[model samples]
Structure formats: C-alpha cells, structure tokens
Target chain A: EERPPPRGLTAPTVAAGAIAKKWLAEHFGVKIRGYMSQLGPIVIPFQSWDEVENNPFYAPNADVVPELEAYMDALRKDGDSIGARIEVIAENVPAGLGEPIYARIDAEIAYAMMGLNAVKGVEIGAGFESVSQRGSEHGDALTPDGFESNHAGGILGGISTGQNIEVSLAIKPTSSIRIKRPSINQAGEPVEVQTLGRHDPCVGIRATPIAESLLAIVIMDQLLRQRAQCGSDWLETKEQE
Target chain B: EERPPPRGLTAPTVAAGAIAKKWLAEHFGVKIRGYMSQLGPIVIPFQSWDEVENNPFYAPNADVVPELEAYMDALRKDGDSIGARIEVIAENVPAGLGEPIYARIDAEIAYAMMGLNAVKGVEIGAGFESVSQRGSEHGDALTPDGFESNHAGGILGGISTGQNIEVSLAIKPTSSIRIKRPSINQAGEPVEVQTLGRHDPCVGIRATPIAESLLAIVIMDQLLRQRAQCGSDWLETKEQE
Candidate 1:
C-alpha cells in the first residue's frame, strides 16, 4: 500500500528465525538466499552468490556495496527513505510440493512475500514483462541445456520444473519516516504526522534475510500440506507395484 | 506459458460444471462471475455487473462489445491470433476463508487463474502497478463506504477483508496458428509446422466460464480444507461459551 503501518524494525526477529530454519533446509540440501537488486534509483545487478554474501547491501554488485552508506546519509538528510526490490532464490527445491489450481509453487511464494510488511507487489520470473512478449521469443525452446531458457520461471502448470525458482518483491518506502505527512487521526480528523524513533533508512536493505525465512516457511508448509492432502508417496508406491 | 497445449474451447463443459456446483455455493449466498476485460487490442473496462451480464464478452464496458469482431478478423488475416486478460469477481464471500502466509485469498486466486490454459500472469487489484505507487496513494483509507480504494484487492494479512475479491489473468496468444513456423520434431530435426483446425482466435474470449468454474472449485476446496484441518464451527462455538 502507499503507506505501511508505522512500527519499529522487526528485521532482527526475522533474521534470527531465518538462521534457525536454515539448518533444517541444509539437512535436505535446499539452499535459499535473498538479496537487494534495487534501492531507489541505484540498481545492483545480480552476479554471484559469493559476492552477494560479502556485500554490505547483500547485493551482488560490489560497486553498489560501497555506495550504500552515502545514499543512506543523503536519504536521512531529506527526512525520506528509499524503497527497494529484493529477490529470493531457492535452489534444490523439490518438485510437486504445491497442489494445482490453488497451491501452486509460484502462488504460494507470492502469498508469502505479500504478507511481509511494506511489500506492495510480487512477481515470478518474467512476470509483468510477459505482457509484451510474442510466443516464439517468450517460449522456452528445448536444447542440450535442458531447455534453452527459463522464461517459465522454473514452474509449469503449478509444479516445479526442477529449475531454480526465483521470486521478487517490490517493497514500498518505509512509512515511519522523519518527515511530516498528512493523515487522518483516530476520529477521522486531518492531521500532520511525523514518526519518531531510530528507523532503517531503507528497510529493503534488511529484507533479504526476512524473505529467505518466509520462503523456507512456505516451502516446508507446502511440503507438509501436500502430504496431508494427497499422500504423494503412497501413490508413487502404488504405481511401482 | 507462451504455448498452452492446443485444444478446443471447453467452455460449454466448464459452464455446465459451474451450474452444478452453484447450488452448493447458493447455500452460503456466494456468487462468482468471470468476464473478459481485454481481448487482443480491444479493452472493455469494468463498469457494473448489470451491464457486464448484458454484453457478449461478459465485460463491464458496453463500448467495446461491438468492436471485438473487427479485431479478430484483422488477427486472422495475418495468420496470427490475439491474447486476452480476464477477471473473476467473487461477492458475498465470508471473511477468513484463506490461511496466512501460504494460502491467502489473493495467492490462491492467482494460483487458480494461472492454472488455466494459455495463462501467463496473474494479478490481484492494482497488482504490478503498485510497484510505482506511493504509500500514501496506495493505502486504502477506511470510510463509511467500506474502502476508498481497492488497491489491496480485498485481502489483508492473508485474510479476506470482506469485500469483493477481484483477480485478473494474462492469457498468452494461442500457439496453434495457421502461420507456418520452424520447430523440432521428436527426433530433434528441424521442420516447418502449420496447424489446421477450428480455434478461437483468442482463447481468453472463452475463458470467462472456465475461470468462474475454477474460482468456485477453489472456494469450495478452501472451505472443506479449512473444515478438515480444523473444526472451525466447534472452535467458534466453544469460544462463545
């Protein structure tokens, strides 16, 4: 929404939780990571995971890592904060975790992301851009590369295509800004509001860890839900017989 | 996906199935409808339910109703077909029908819509455009009129906001075009292929009934799933005591 609710940074809790759940995923060989791709106008293109881990912004671009401090100082001076686009990528996620027509992999991911504070939009691979694409250019042609492209975003017909699944979310600018803005009070009277407290200049900067935590929760939840509903293993055993 | 498997319009069956299920939903006063909002280049803007029912496209706008024919004729001349964007609106739905984080109303709706043939994208309310929106402008203010805007698409924190649920899907152009195209056969050799059959120029033109049926299935599934997962009525009754 235009304004997320004013609150202290819940970033610490999200990070702590993610750290705990990460171990569970590691046991299963599922790896998940999140990184900042955009901070207002400063875009740090995706590179390698090693570089993203080393950077202060959790961005793959080394150049933008050093520039984040100066940008935050400027943002603080203006009583404003920058928004962000953060991406979460999951590798080695098993196929068929989601159910069709309701609990698809991408759909569940979108739900998890949209539930986060300040998240205004969510998209799977090649999402909104697909609006302008033609069939030939957009279709994923098969080659020795196990399908020449990933235009399908690792999921087809609601099931994982055994490719790395990527999800992106657009986080709105932090609402708890030092700047004054118009708002209606509890009784619906117009008033000017300026939030007070030490707040993160770009909350998106802290979003990576939180996004990973949510992704882990969704994956695990879907795994259990599918078992409860369909007993996928039972069907497999029956087929083998 | 750019190419949904070629098949005849299954509109009649979808409509009949929905009619059969409508009785069950009637028990709860829930009503759902799907309509075309965009056909190739012709756009029928959402207006009112009364007028949408009167139009052949099931679109809210009466203005574009008569213009669909010319666009399809123009599409056929080039051996190409158009795509579509359709919307499904569900009214009188009870609140708290979906689960948090993984099975939110909007997320489930997106999953259902994306499962349809030729569907490439899904959005709820203001969706992707929310990427560019300011928090102040995007936040729906509470008024006696319910909500001043629908930017959130009638769901909040993964629960129903007790308003009309709106979902939209982008359907890719039909892949079975008469125009010849280069492709690989089963043996991986290059060949020119041309499809011959009766095809709807835009499959989305017939997606309204299918979408409605799918939406019905999702709602019913959620209802039963919720009941199965937790005895909702018993818990509520116990709380009252």
Candidate 2:
C-alpha cells in the first residue's frame, strides 16, 4: 500500500500489491500467494484466503472451528500459547533468478523467514522429510514435458528450476504469557516475571501478511540483483530460451 | 594497508590493518587474527603465520611435508583436487555488537563465508560437533569469573557474548579440474567436458587471505550497524560498563 502525500506535495508513483501483481502477470506471467497451512495443532486442508480473512480462527472443516475455539480458550485461561505453520508459493518464477554458491533463492528465503518474529525454522519443498527419502524418490524426475515432482522446491543446486517455489515456516508460540516465569535479574538475583498489557496469545494468527511481505521484499531484492548482474534483458532472454 | 593517493591529489586517511590493530588495542583492547587450520588434509598443530607466509604448504610438523607433497603430486597426476579448512578468531569483541533475530553476527559471518569461492560449509565454535554431544556438554557453563567455555562461539541469542568469535569454513575441492567429465550440450545432447588453462589444484591454499578479508568486512559492517542503532558511543559505553 502507498502512503498519502503531504498537502503541498505529490508522491512518487509506484505500482504495488494488486497493481504490481497485475503488472507482473501481464509482463511475466508470474503469480504469488501466501496462506497458512496449520494453526496451532490443526492442519488446513483447503486453499481459501477469504475464509481465513472472514474469521481469524478459520478451519477448513466447519466442525473443527468449535474445537479450535475451545483449545484457544483453554490456552488463554492457562496463560499459554501455541505455534503455527505458514506456506508461500510463487508460480512460474523465472529460472536463474538466484545467485548461486551464496545468495541462493532458498538461502535468502531461509534468512528472511528466520528474521521474522517467532520463526523457529524454515523448509523448502520436502525439507526435513527428504532426510528420510531415498535419492531416487527425493530427486524430481526430469521429462520432456516438465519435472514429475517438486521435491526440490522449485530450486536445483541453488537456482530456480522453473517450478512453483514452495516455502514453509515454523513459528514458535508467543512468549509474552500472563503466567509468572522465573528469570535472573540484572543483578543476577532470582526474579519472577509476568507479562502485562496487550499481548498476542498466538502471534502466528496474524503472521500471514508479514510473511507475504517478507517474500515480496526478497523477490524484489533478487530481481534488482539479477538486473544489475545480468542486464535488463536477462528475463526476456531467459524466456526466449 | 591504505591506498596511495593520485599525483597532486590528497586522499582521506583511515586506520587499517596494522594501524587499525594498534588503534583497537589502544582504545578498546580488541585483537583479531585469521589463520589456516588445515591445508588440504593437513591439520596445523601450531599457530604460525610467518611459517605459512614462508610456504603456502606449511605444515606444523616438518616430517609431514614430504607426504603432503607426494599426495599433491598424485592429485596433479590424477587431475583431481582436494579440500581445506580455515579459521578466524576475534578476541575481546565488544558484547552486544550484533542485531538480534535478523542481522545476527553469526548469520552475517555465515553469509560472508558462504559467498567465498569453493566454500561448502561453515561452523561457529563447536558447530556440527555439538550435534553428537548432550545438551549439558554442549552448553557453555557460566561462572563468576567468566564463561567456562565458548561453545556458543561468542554469540548467544544472536548477540555477541564478548568471548572470542571463532569461525571455521570448509572449502570444497576446486570444480575446475583437468579431468574430463560428461555433460549436456545446449541441444541436450551428451558431450565430454574438459577444463583447460591455468587452475589451482587446491583453491583453499590461497583462501586464507580471502577468508580474513571477509571476516574483516562482516565485522566492520556489524560495527557500523551497531553504531547506527546503539549510538556512536556504544563501544565506549560498553567498555565503561
């Protein structure tokens, strides 16, 4: 969103959000979306941002809403918090957008996610699950048509592989609980600390927008770097190839 | 070392290298050093830069030189390559020099190290070794005098802990080997690929200076960031405290 200009001044024009999305689709045929995969202990089964926007405690199955509400109520009563998982996907991301050996797209995504508040872990594609998978199963099979799978999370050897980019983040429970916690003071003496004032019992409930913003920032950064290193026609040349 | 100015032009003077070292010692009591921990497969047993400067293949024990020479000869004959490890240490780094959650000192260092050519892995303090150790053994014990050990590598919770920062890097074998390999052509046809021209048999042999330079860069960046966020008198105030 663009901020309003001062009374006597005109703000610089820039495309952002829906406008940027439309521009990208028209120019590069790229589409990006962010959604929650899990809220606390419940897993989301459907892709519906409208449902989530309508209700912060939105669950795919209508029957699960009451159960989630009850669980949240219990957590609030006990002065506790819960964790969540989020996923962001970019369809038709341009290949070779990443700088390999260091500033890889996956590495940049990890850095951005970890920088977010309460983010404890990050995964691309199969991630930790690949540890249990065999090489034959883990590697995406290449075909004349396209890749048979997306286990690499749209990246291969630190570069985009022309598949949908899938990134997941593990957000830890909010720490500012009402319950008293034992901690050491500046003087190294024992202290009982209790949080006061407004606090989020589950910070991840409102983290979708922040996560999406981070992805946008990283993508923009990569685009600038790519243009600087590969020239302005890099994307057009790649598309032709 | 400062760059010499052009004829009839005065250059802005800034402390660097030995002068910077002297200045830091005089003002803040900080000492930084970078050295090779291993050359190829040789693990250095002594800290000696003079010895390394005299000979890039300098091994702690003189008896191992002939064996290492033989190994290098074999690699050259086979048109293969080997790897090496390097370490850099900064003593008495002021506490709280790093930004938390995002621009952590360790994360920045990792980024810098990974950006180096042929570097495949990075470690801080105990690093991967801690994976096999129990929590009790891995965590550094705090005492009245100071930390019993520095397993955290001078950083905890993304902030500097005032301990010596210890970083190690794993340099992979040079990819530009003389040996021929199979590869795909632009038309997706099979072909044999062979590298020609001057190439280092071991890129890591020349990586010491580069690694040291990167550490200096990251440290200087952190210092600037710390000053900007915590005020120009941050280091002075930290020292006084």
Candidate 3:
C-alpha cells in the first residue's frame, strides 16, 4: 500500500517486519508489543496494552488523540519534521536465559534495538535514571510476593528476573527530510541538497512491529543460549539435529 | 589478597583476569581501563588516564585522595554495606567493528558487563541522559572533526564510529554482607544467618581489573567478528586460525 501508513509516515518496507513478528509470536507464545510514548515534543501518558490496541496513531494510549490531530495539522500547516520515542514490551521471557557479563540479557537487548536505523537510544526500565540513584535505592528488594520494585527492569545480575522486559528506544528525526541542507559531494565541494527517496516523517510510528521482530530475535537467541547454559530442558520438543 | 576486600567483599577469583588483559593490551593497540566512578554515594568525576594512575582505592585517578581516605576511614568505622559504579573505557576501537543489528557492538559490551555478578546497571557515554534531550540537541552533527560529539558513546546504528568506547556499569553490593540478615534455607526454615566466607566489602573495589578483563574479552570477540565480517586487513598479523 502506497498510502501513508495508518500508524505513521514510515516506509512500508520497514514496517513490514510486523507481519513476520505476528506469526512468530504465535509460535513462540511470547507477546511483543510496542507503541509510541512520545512524538516530537508531544508526550503521551502511558496506557495499558488494552488501550494501546485502539490508537490510530499507534501510540500507547488515546491520551494524545487531540494533541496528535493538532500536531498533524500543524505539520501540514508548517511542513515540519518530527521524531518518536517507542516503548516495546516483551512478556513471558524465562528467567536464567541470558549469559553472564559477556553475553547478558540487557546488553543483548540494547545491542539489538540500537542496531535499528533510527534508534538513537535504548533504555531498559529506568536505565539512565539509575545513574542518579544510590545503590540502596536502586537495588530491588526481594519479598515472598516477588520483588518489591522492578527498578532493575525485570533484570537482576544480568539475568531475567522473570518479570516482563520493557525497553524504550529513541528514534531520531528522519534525515531524509525535503529541507535543503549543505553537504560536500564526493569531490568535497560544498553544495546545497534536498533528499529525495522513500522516507518516513517519524519512522518510529511504524516501528512497533519492527521492534517486536528484533526483540523476538534477541529472545530466540537467548532461548538457545539458555538451553546451552542452563541445560536443554526447554528444547525438549526440538528434533535432534 | 586473602583478606576481605576493603569495600564490598568478594572472592578474588574475578580479579585474576586483569593480568591476562595487561598482556593482551601490549599486543593490540586497544587499551581498556576501568575504575570506581561511585562508591556508595560518593561520586568521583571522570579523570584522564594520567590522573587516574595513582589511586589506592582502585580508581584510575589520584584526584580523590582526600575523599578516598575519608571514605576508607568511614568504611573501616561503620563496616556497613556498599556498592560501586565502574566506568570502563576502550580506546582506539576501530569503526564498523560490530554487526548492524543482530551482532551489535553496544549489545556485546552490555552483555559482557551485565554478566558480571552484582552489576545492576550499564550505560554507554551519555546513556540515559539522552532520554530528556531534544532531537536537535541529541543528534551529533557531522564535521571534519570526525563525529563532532560522541553522545552516541562511540556507537552509531550498532557499529563503532571510530571513537573511544565508554561504558558505565553499576555493581551491586556483595550478597555476603557481614550484617545478620533473614533468608530461607532450602528446607523453608526462616533463619537469621551471617555469611562466612572470603568476601570483599564492595566487590567493585577489585572489579576495576575484572572489568578491564571483561572489556578485553568483548573487544577481542568483536575484533574477531570485525575480522570475520570485514576480513583480515585489520588483523595484519594473525596466526592461521
């Protein structure tokens, strides 16, 4: 479909990964979902998965419905470029799945997400915020009813805490905007150029599926690693190769 | 070395890897350094390699002389639990050293760091701070001065941009604190027990060298990956493998 994406203006070629993720999720029994938490400077309050499913903008909630329409109107009015911050959730990841220190869960997740074309940042739960916290404040206290807090973002000592894995990624503004900008060509002479190609206004708008796919890939890799490190119990159904 | 570590007590097993790292760095141009950035609530600002060399508290810097002495005195006085934040720097990393998505550099680094015991969080350069910055502010502008800024922490789209790679790791307090704490034995008996074993007070005290070693392993893995992906021009003197 050549039409503007129902979620955002990203090229369909990129967003197309969602279809594959949908199929993989069914086979894996892992639910992966992503939604825009922020668009440009327009921030949206977080919504549960139930609420996120209905958003036409593919945002996590309807909290920004009016703001979204107004922003879209303003974009059309002033022809400005925008960016998005996407949050992805991966549920049902088994604990004891990641390798320690060298092949870790958080490290793997960060690597996968940052590898995306426009992702400028990746945070697991309260990632960077923890830098400002004290050791006592940041450490998750354990209780009989599970962890009192998930400040560790479902990961502890680099292994899955059996809590849902949450990752937020920052997708930078598309550099392919039509605005004319100065650049040096191959011979190094400065020239003003306007980009022309398949582009997305905010590529993150359509990135949910892609995020899911990447998470799936990481999860799958970890699953195999878990089998190798922890034993092959999870791979009981696998045909001997 | 048989004595309990002055900070978070730890087994000496981890610190042994640094000896090998020192030898490895001599052969390769890449040099890895790690030291305590935070001890409990005390924060030591980043220091240059020259300043960091003479620290007695395992910091790379001699800058925290007064603070280090006072902190050590207090640790000896109260004998309370504490943790450390370690920052590891990898210098002279070649660009394009990581896979675009699946086998990314940041992911590899994070995995290596997080896999270590007691590491609570990991950051790359201005890691989590970018969460609040604007797109215009966060995006590193291209210049003849290379990347102009390394807010991306030497990685872009999962590949090294030929910058010094910086990693910050938050190491949790050692679990074997001398404090009398409550825990359930395997028989489900609630018991107040004191851990008796060889332990460091703050495991991070000895971790600088260990962190250095882990970083070495990751760099070597990525270096081999780089050679495999980009071929042997980078490894001009490799023995047949």
Candidate 4:
C-alpha cells in the first residue's frame, strides 16, 4: 500500500481514557490497586494482532503487579471467558436534539454503539423490556413539569425532550484462548496451534470509556447539526418573547 | 374558533415560502422577484380575504390605477399565467463527495429536493432518459484525464467525481386556479368559488432555483461532515507525506 494506516484512532482513545480518569477522580475520589487494562487481541488501526506473552497479566504470579491481573489470569485458566458492558448516561440535555425524516437520534446512537468492537447490540431506556409492556405502561405521560415516567428515554419523535438520555451495550466474549484450537493459515490451509498468552477474559471489561466517547461524538455531531439549522431562530424568538 | 377556517394549511404555506426563499438565497444565486406580483398566492399573512382583494393581481379593473393596471389585466387575460423555474448547476465539485451507507449523496440530494414545496419528483443528469440508453452509450468511460463523458452527472457511489452535479425538479400544478370546481368548506358544506385572480400557470416555473437551494444545503452539509470525518485527516496526512 502506498499510504500507511493513519493514527487517527489515538486521539479518540486518549480522549476517552482522559474522560474515564476524570470521572474516576471526581466521583470515586480514591486510588485503586490497578488501572483499566485494555485487553486487546487485535488493533483496528493497523489490522494486526498484538502479542501478549510478555504482558504482566500473563504472569502466573502477577498479583505483585495488580490484583486485577490475578482475576484476569484465573478467568483465562478456564475455557470460559468474560464480557464487558458499557453504560453511557448524559444529563441536562435540552429538548429537540434530533431532526425528523431520516436523521433520527436513536438511529444515530445505535450506529455509534454498534460501530464499537465486540459490541453486539445497544438499547435505550427500558431496552427491549418496553416490548413486553402495554401501551399505557410504556408510553411516557407528559406533565407541566416534564415526563411523569422516563420509559420513553427522554426522546419522542426522535428528538430529545430535555431529560437525561441513557444507553447501554452488551459486549461479546473475547475470542482469544490459551487452549488448542483449529485455525487457518495465510495459505488457506487448516492448522492447529495451542495459543499461549494473556488476554482479557472479557474484552468489554475496559470498554466503558470507549462507549462514553462514542456517545460524546454522536451528541456533539447532533448538537452542531441542530444549532446550524434552527437554534439561532429559536434563540431569537425566545429572546423576543 | 379563534383560529382561521383553514387551520392546518395556513402555517405550512408561510413556512414553505420562507424556507423556499432562504433556500434560494443560500444555494442558488438568483435574486427573489422584487415586485408585488411575484409573491406566492398564499402569502396573505392574515385570514382576511379583503386583504387579498386589495392586491393588484386580485383587484378588478375599477381601482386598478395606471401604476398596477397592466399587471392586473395580464393576470386576467393570460390563458396560462407565468411561473418561474430556477436551475442550479454545481461546478468543479471534487471527487468523492459522499459517504457509503444510508448517507449516500444522491439519496440525500433527492430527500432534500422532495422536502421543498411543489416539488413532485426529482431527476439527475439525463434522468429517466438514461433508461433508454444502452450500457455502452450510457456508461462514462474512464480515461487518463478523467471521465470521457459527463452522462453520470459527476456522481458515483453517491459521491461527486469532480464533475458538475446537475439536478432538476418537477413542480406540480398550482391548486388555486381561476376555474371553478367542487369543494368542501371547513364546516363540511359543499361550496363552489372560482379561484379568482392571477396565479402561475405552471407551479414548476419558479421551482428551479428553490431546487438548487435544496441541493446546495445537502451538498454543504455533506461537505462539512466529510471534512470532519475524512478530509481533515487527509490534509494532515498530506502534510506529513
């Protein structure tokens, strides 16, 4: 290839990590035994696998490094793997954050979450639980103050209704394992090799901040779009009133 | 009722006209007609018909003084009234203007055009005429310089391929005509009133520039989006190279 792969992914990953650190500092107000280890089998930037044989988590007695490593090692000992889930909640969102026709907020949010690695699916408030409820039960009733219920997730007609918007994602089990497994080589030949290395028992264990960053990207884009189209007029009218 | 009889229709007409004017100014270079006769028929701004009767185009010849008499007379005598059509052709558009997936450039352009008033349908370069063309004739062959033919209208994969983007819209016939027809009032009472006064013979005549404006909005939006996601990186990478 004439051009090398771009390093654009670095900026977002760094930004997400910074956000997570700030959240931890502000809310938890405590230092933990370990850091959020990004367990990775592959990096999308270069489309290459990272060797984890020398990783601290791979050490049999890596408890000296961090207790989380011990937890990850024990999970790796078993054939089973772990999975991660990331929840993103945004508060103080103004009403009307989306457009009608095709530019729906839910659709955009879903796309953002789905674009993440190992993320199987995403859901708004109540998720698929809404499907089991009756119309009266699920439909959020409006009041002078605001919605009496939040089953609607602060969105109606694809626009935000000046409430907290929330979303969650289900991450799939990490694929790497130490056990022997069937595989194919570059020549398209069937082969088998015993994998040896440390990996995240659940890849999603560290993806929370990544999900938050994705949500941030979606919200920022929507904010810009809404402001460009109708925000100025709405502000002017409100000022006149 | 405090509201006028034609409740639902009133707001949309004014809104559509205002949006149409803004769209024209931003996207196309054409200046809106300055004279009084050019106003869309429904721009009465109020429910009063007396105001409509006062318009030079609507007034009878009695008080139609010399200043506005000829214009009013032309409205009555012309078997078909005059309408305007605005055409917008984007020149020197760069290659690769749109993204894949639902945000395809052509679809966005079509959606924007359809949003405009009186725009029944839209067509791209050569439009339906291309259906009759053979593959060899219709296909824009590649060459060292670029495409040998402009039949594709400078779009491929919903992206601009460094060619002029051509679009046209068909405006429907104006509903308010001089001829009398069966109709129902807001009270569900049957009534017949001749659509007295001057109106465009064909609604599409003035639609060209409006269509251009819609196209421009879509193009500008897509350009900004493309810049944010892809072009910014491109610039950085080029500088590095």
Scoring each candidate complex against the real one, what DockQ results? 0.19, 0.06, 0.22, 0.01
- Candidate 4 residue pairs that clash: A82-A201, A82-A202, B84-B205, B84-B206, B85-B205, B85-B206, B86-B208, B86-B209
The pairs that clash in candidate 2 are none
Ranking by TM-score: 3, 1, 2, 4
- Given candidate 4, what's the lDDT at residue A85? 38
Top-down DockQ ranking: 3, 1, 2, 4
Q: What DockQ does predicted model 2 obtain?
A: 0.06
**Which digits, one per residue and each the tens of the lDDT, describe model 4 over residues A1-241?**
1233222343665486466445433432311111122232321121111321233332212223355456556656664454433446666555677854456676566655544544443556654343233333444544444556775555554577666676756555544444444544666565554444555556565565566666666665676576578777763442343
What is the C-alpha lDDT profile of model 1 across B1-241, one tens digit per residue?
A: 1444544335654765576358435556678887887776566777877777786667777777768767667777777666677788777666677865556656666655665656666666666555445444555665544567777666665566767777777776665677676667788776666765676656676778888887777776766666677797843542343
Residue B144 in model 2: shift from native, Å? 1.2
Candidate that would win on lDDT: 1
Give model 3's docking category. incorrect
Categorize the docking of model 4: incorrect
Residue-by-residue lDDT tens digits, candidate 2, A1-241: 1233212101111223445455455556777677667766576676555565556653334545676678778878877666677777778777776866658776676656655545544556765444233333444555545667887778655677789988776665655666665555677666656665566667676666666656655666677688788887986675554
Expressed as tens digits, the lDDT of each residue in A1-241 for candidate 3 is 1234223223442354455455446545567778878877778887666777686667766767788878766653443356677888787666666745556777777666666666655667665455445444555555455556766777765578777788877666554445554544676566555554445555666667678777777777777665676576555533121
Candidate 1 residue B213 Cα shift, in angstroms, is 4.2
**Each candidate: what lDDT?**
0.67, 0.62, 0.64, 0.48
3 versus 4: better DockQ goes to: 3
